[model samples]
Target chain A: MLFHVLLLITFIIVILIYEWKHYQGRDRYVFVMLFALASIYLLAAIVDWRIPEYVQGVDFLLSPLKKPLQAWLDQFQI
Target chain B: MEQKISSIQFTVLVFMNTLGTAIIFIPTIATRYGRENGWITVIFATLLGMVFILWLTTLIGQEDDTNFFKIMDNRVGKLISYCLILLMVSFIFFTTFANIWSIAQFVSLQILMGTPPQVLALISTFTGLIAVRYGLEVIVRSAEIFFPFTMLSLTLLALLVWPEAQLIRVQPVMQLNQAATFVGVLPVIALTYMELIVMLVVLPHVNDLRQAKKAFLIGGGLAGFCIIIVTFAAIAVLGVDGTVRHAYSIYVLGQNIQIAEFFERIEVLVAFIWFITIFFKVSTCFYFLSIALQHMLKVKNYHSLTVPLGMILLATAMTNLPNIFYDFEMMNSTYLILSYITGLTVATVLSLAMLIRKYKEKVK
Candidate 1:
């Protein structure tokens, strides 16, 4: 957990320093967006969120097709 | 913007990209359904992949120095082009996640038993970041050098395992379970072969667009043939039941290679060759992430985003995938198939619309 926080802080500092050196005007917007995303993800990781369960688009969306495939594979007594 | 790769380099990149972590698990995955005839499923999937590659290369080759997004923008306008870009980005992200996460899992399980998976995932992404920093041409050139060495190791492993390969293990070859075999092809198609769509990003970078058509065909064909050989070796050496029982049957196949009482423990070499393959795979995904984001944002330099994006990939791989079972579930499910087909279909539809518009413009 502490490692995640340290990594996030280091990432933000690095990006900020990079932006300061390069200092392209609108490019800061991209950096800001990136930093925000990294924070959310890193914090989420630290929180031990059920991340995979939410992205269950794979499960919910494709559940219909899954059963048929399971049934087919089960028929072969390997 | 300066396209530097020749036809040969493009071909090698395609071969290396197609040969990703699939090489590690396709034997087990396919054998689970097709039994002794599992290799046949791989061949069928490869053939299907070839058709898609030909269609893809021809679609992009029609316009000079063009890519998938540019073509979409030309035909469908910027609004829909952005939407399609998002879809492609998601597909690429999911792909990179699957490959890197699987590598982390395998390394932690097979070799580095003490290391945390997140650290392994980060380390793998770091290697990819270095390649992405060097740019696409460097990655392609590196593949050109590494491709031969990887292939030689694979070939040596094959020869060493040949004596243990009992033909009797695959005796009931003709009688195949049609439904299971078809189901087996789904993962190979969704996870492995359909990844040739990376060509849509790469084709525009080739020096000769004309050569790209042939390059992709040959590359996809060669890659398919190589995968078939790996699958055949796995089934023959381990038998259908044995192969299906293990998660990574190819690595197990390597463990049986006890030649001259000296050339044992060749799984180390197999792992190294797969490392090269996965490195190229992750590098290609990182390159796609950088360039695609640059194009989407209309930024001057994608290189600036490479490291930051690599950081996201590492985090996502750590957080997004909980275990190897989830990875297997993703592969064996239809979710990836549906997603990949949707992206390919949209790209193809948009491209076809562009071609029609072009023809109509010319006629007018």
Candidate 2:
């Protein structure tokens, strides 16, 4: 995991360097955003975080509606 | 956005895009709930998905040739537009992540049992990144070349496997568990149709925007039709119980081909079709992600982010999703709703809001 994290960071640095010239003007924001996103992913992977859990909140919120939705659709099943 | 694709390319790209991982899973997932009536869900989902594509095109129609992000920015304010962009970006990225994971799982399980999942995930994402790096034109053109092979392979497989199908397997005709059948509709729609959201991104890049409607219908309809055939084939060939028992019903279906004594083991050809379709799917998602991020961050070029995004996708694909069971649960339930409702609600609201604003201006 640690090796993977290092590898990801190394790739990000190479990309940053390769695209450094394009970072002029508003493109700098993309540079920053890409760097930050890649870093977060690297960090998350290293920590072995179950990243799906972060997105599962939406799943939980929508769970209550599934049954009712299913019941309603069942009416036409016959 | 300087490059543009013709309607034919757009249509073919749509077919490839919609074909994604659903081909592998829908047979089992749909039949598990809808039983012998699983094919019915395909027809229903296609019709309903047609309505959705119509509604989406109408939304795009209101904006002339403006891209989705700008349309959103204009309809809702900047902040809300940014929020929607985040939602869309996450949605597309998550999709790419999921597909990478899925293909990795599929390859490791079926094709290369000895390969590490992480290696497979990287290879899958890398192929997509290469296409994305060249821009949408490369992706669409490659789809043009790949689309025929995809369809031809599917046809050949169907022909080869048709003889093995026991029509009796699809027995007890309309005895579907209504609730399960209806609940079944969500995943099929989510898996196949909701992906039309990518159309919104690609539309502005289309050469003749007027052909968007026709392109969408033919492409989406054909893609849905393919799924229907696959579902029917799986049920007829494997039956509901057998279909549900296998992780990849389509892959298993391919394994059933026993022509002459020498014509066995044709799954390699089938795997090729799966590879290109999933590759295009991931590339399409990755394309949209880069474009959306460029717009959101006010970047000038989208290309530079491709490598970074690919890296993120690799990491996420490797570690983000839980085990196969959890992944399946999410796809059938939460993801089905989240992908469909969130997209439909947002697009409808934005379109209606745009229409209302037009009316107010006319009144004034």
Which ten-residue region of model 2 chain A has the weakest summed lDDT? A69-78
For model 1, which pairs clash? none
Q: B175-253, model 2: which lDDT tens digit per residue?
A: 7465666667777888888877877888877877779678988898998898889889999998888888887888889
For residue B54, model 1's alpha carbon misses the true position, in angstroms, by 1.0
Query: Candidate 2 chain B: minimum summed lDDT over ten consecutive residues — where?
Result: B59-68
lDDT of 1 by residue, B1-364 (tens): 6657889999999888888877888888888878888998898888888887777766664565445567668767898778777767777887887788899899999999989877888889989999988888999999999988988988887788899999988767757576677667777877676776666787888888888789988887887888899999999999998898888888998899897898787898779878999999999988888888888887677766776687677777877778877777677665465556655776577667767877999999
TM-score of every candidate relative to the true structure: 0.93, 0.92
State candidate 1's TM-score: 0.93
Residue B254 in candidate 2 has what lDDT? 89
Worst 10 residues of 1 chain A by lDDT: A50-59
Docking class of 2: acceptable
Worst 10 residues of 1 chain B by lDDT: B59-68
DockQ of each: 0.42, 0.39
